[model samples]
Target: MPRPDRPTRPSARSGVAPFHVMEVLAAAKARQRARGDALLLCTGQPATPAPRRVRAAAAAAAAEEVLGYTEAAGDPALRAAIAAWHRGRYGTAVTAGQVVVTTGVSGALILVFLAALDPGDEVVLARPGYPAYRNTLAALGAEVVELDCGPDTRHQLTAEMLAALPRPPRAVIVTSPDNPTGTIIDEAELARIARWCAAHGTLLVSDEIYHGIDYGRRCASALESSAAAVVAGGFSKYFSMTGWRLGWLILPEELVGPVTRLAANLTVCPPAVSQAAAAQALHPESLAELDGHVRRYRDNRDLLLEGLAAAGIDRVAPADGAFYLWADVSDYTDDSLVWCAELLDRTGVALAPGVDFDAVHGGGRVRLCYAGAPGDLAEACRRLSRVTGRA
Candidate 1:
């Protein structure tokens, strides 16, 4: 039997690209353990803790209620709370039956992909986007069609690009308050893209994970444009609940059942305590507290921008929303990975290389997240200035 081809060890689908920012984060952690001074601007996790009410609610649930699994689609109360939250934010008629809570936005994405895509189906997205979108779809045998988005368009996708694609995709993802680059698609332009997708018979997966963290102008939710879109949202960003493992997807009536069936087989249900606590997370007082965190992010962003310009590294993406500043570091090095590794070594300041976001043209770019305290950001800028010889 020819020795059975040496026991073909791993599945080909398991070879999805590593989310490289995680490697950067691992390095940062190691540097911190050794020197106790590393500054991490690589991940988008907020510096603040979860809201007090959320924490208290989780604790109360632990103390008072059984932590067994709820329904596969998640707790009806939590889903209802999420629907009400959307109705208040975007003036949409969101009903509880349309919501499916998942382990996180990552989990929601997997269910969404499984429900909407078949093998060989194509999904169109911007090139310099969240890497997981490509990796997840590829792992499931879906074709990822990338549109090149650059500075001329402020790193956003337009309806014109969708029309010009070789063929319409099975789905198109729109991330406002985008990852890596904090660019917000204009509300009017978003509506145009929504209409284009509708006309082309394509599913629109709107990732509004960073909804409440805009810099100046308010970002619009896709429900304001297309009620048919599958909206993926989570508590990680604005709610400061990264480790809580709670997120929800708002689907059209047709999709809810399919996605719920997938979730039943995949996750069984989201965490019981998390769904219980998330109900309190939507409280008015909790929201007000979360807004304060956004204010701190804005302050940190301003400081980093000024400091980077003073350090003579001026080429940057428009940080219209989100906590990341996508910076061009071509003046320093052509390869961002090497530059990032060396920068961490020399100054103990870690940032994500842009290759993680844009494999085509991101070797000379970097993304620095401002979801940290002002003091840490200022000290990081000081170290960067000194290390880059701009001091």
Candidate 2:
């Protein structure tokens, strides 16, 4: 068998970093299959099922319509629904012509990278961001320039940092309710960053996947800052429709056609059933159901924070939103990967190592998902206390 690192026909793209959370999740699942007691706190997947209206919509589409491919830009009605949804949520003037449906946020990122960047171009993002940003850009031969964003800046990019870069990158990506930290950018600060990018002629790519899951203050969209911003969103996180693989990008007038063209060749069109279901996902009934899931996630987040503190893990990131608790576990072990492996072996509680998010400081950190059931989170806390020898 050919090894991953020594494959016979490996291209440079094959060398992109793997998503460690998914790797850990696969391990956790295997352990559950064998031992039947794994506590999964890795990966940001909601335990809630899709809303009844969305499911009904998908079933109805399957029964009534041909499952054939829609237009490459997605169904016109779905695009209109997404535009209306964005307009209502963020008070932005979005039109259906600006929307292009994608296979997922992952696909949106790839398409954006392909459309906006050339080989050897640079993309700037905050450190400890979603790993896919780095890996995806790297796979496309784009140089990823990471801004070291510690807790002092709420783990978000700042305008000063962008100004200090040796030269402007081709694009700058920002995420609110950020991955690995769950810290949202201040609206004013985000606007400043957007202005800086616009002045510097850098394309602003905003990952708004975690929107609608905020705790207290709702996160701001990049569109509020710049008209040229490229916004990527999906039904995966907030809508609890992970397997649906429905995501979209809101583009400027110039890039819409190019991205749509790229998307046409990429996957032809997103799933017909998923598009039908996602249309209903934006309905009032579905939004209400999703809000209930957010409430449960909020409660679970509170429980996890208290439990971590009680277990002497007090140096956690300030998770203002999202269902993740990025904890500093340096007191327990230096290498988070090894620590996570031991934790799974001893306690059957799986978590994503910090290294997946940050290559330099990640060895001392881990990301725990609080998107599971409340009972499971409580049990995870108990198992963590036992494993860490908390009194």
Candidate 3:
């Protein structure tokens, strides 16, 4: 018999992790209210609203007939459109049957993990990688084996790094145009990793959510090299559709049934209206609007790099893609949590602590998102300079 006064116990998986950035932001918000001045550069969200087309699509969807659930996998027309988009963008031949629509890329990740791994199975993930990968894996009862890839490797996971792991993992998660670090794994490296995963029977979960946001080089798809890969993507980043909460997964034919079954049990299907808008996002005109957003991100990335360097905070990884700049702040402070807190308190400029991305060296670094307006970024840089005493 349990004591009436006792607190309910939480499961181990529930104790997995917290995204430290959220805490920092909360604290920063409090401090901002107290001081009444601050600029936020810490968030990974774009400051821009969803593109005109996306909004139009959503409005069109809302007005259009009864909003009801579509297929578990997704609306067939949307899947076909997504397949076609991939073909036009990457020159990769994909089919509608290979696509699995989910609530978001986050949902896609959970589905992929469920479809690929058993309880206690280990999956290799890059350290200083996206926090969700580790947290999601733990929640699903899978062991997350974190591989440390530092700035030397552009904070990317490579075939050599994978080979050095003590044992081959049950699956591996690779994010190109990765979060925090914003590095893109080249085609050769992607191919090598895909081949290695195939040879070792390791499922490859390739996160291509940042595909269209690259600066110059073409983004590589794991599906181009191996059939054992699960490609996760969404309209959040490139299409400026974060609030829409629409994303997708392209899985191998054999795993489609299991993924669909899991999706049916978990979400039943993504939101009907969002799915309808997502279908519009797949249109050529909508894609053109998305590409324009990507170009803006690229410009923001350039501005941030130049501004940070000019401010004497020059130690930053090359942000080939994605809208984040992972900077080494070891010279100023080893404890990034403290630094970030102090910086936020002092300047009202929010920044993500390295701890959110890397458990190892995260203490000495910080990640700044450049997804805001150019003027905001410039102003944030100025505030950062003053806050860091580098102005």
Clashing pairs in 2: none
lDDT, candidate 1, 356-385, per-residue tens: 999977898999999987888889989889
* Rank list by lDDT: 1, 2, 3
Q: Over 4 Å off in model 1, which ranges?
A: 5-8
Give per-model TM-scores: 0.98, 0.97, 0.96
Q: Rate the local accuracy (lDDT) of all candidates.
A: 0.92, 0.90, 0.86
Candidate achieving the largest lDDT: 1
Tens-place lDDT per residue, model 2, 182-300, is 99999999899888888989999999999999999769999998998999999899999999998999999999989989988988999989997788888898899999999988999
Span of ten consecutive residues with least summed lDDT in model 3: 2-11
Please identify model 2 stretches exceeding 4 Å from their true place: 1-8
Backbone clash count, each prediction separately: 0, 0, 2
The TM-score ranking, best first, is: 1, 2, 3
The alpha-carbon deviation from the true structure for residue 22 of candidate 2, after best TM-score superposition, in angstroms, is 2.8
RMSD of each: 1.1, 2.7, 1.7
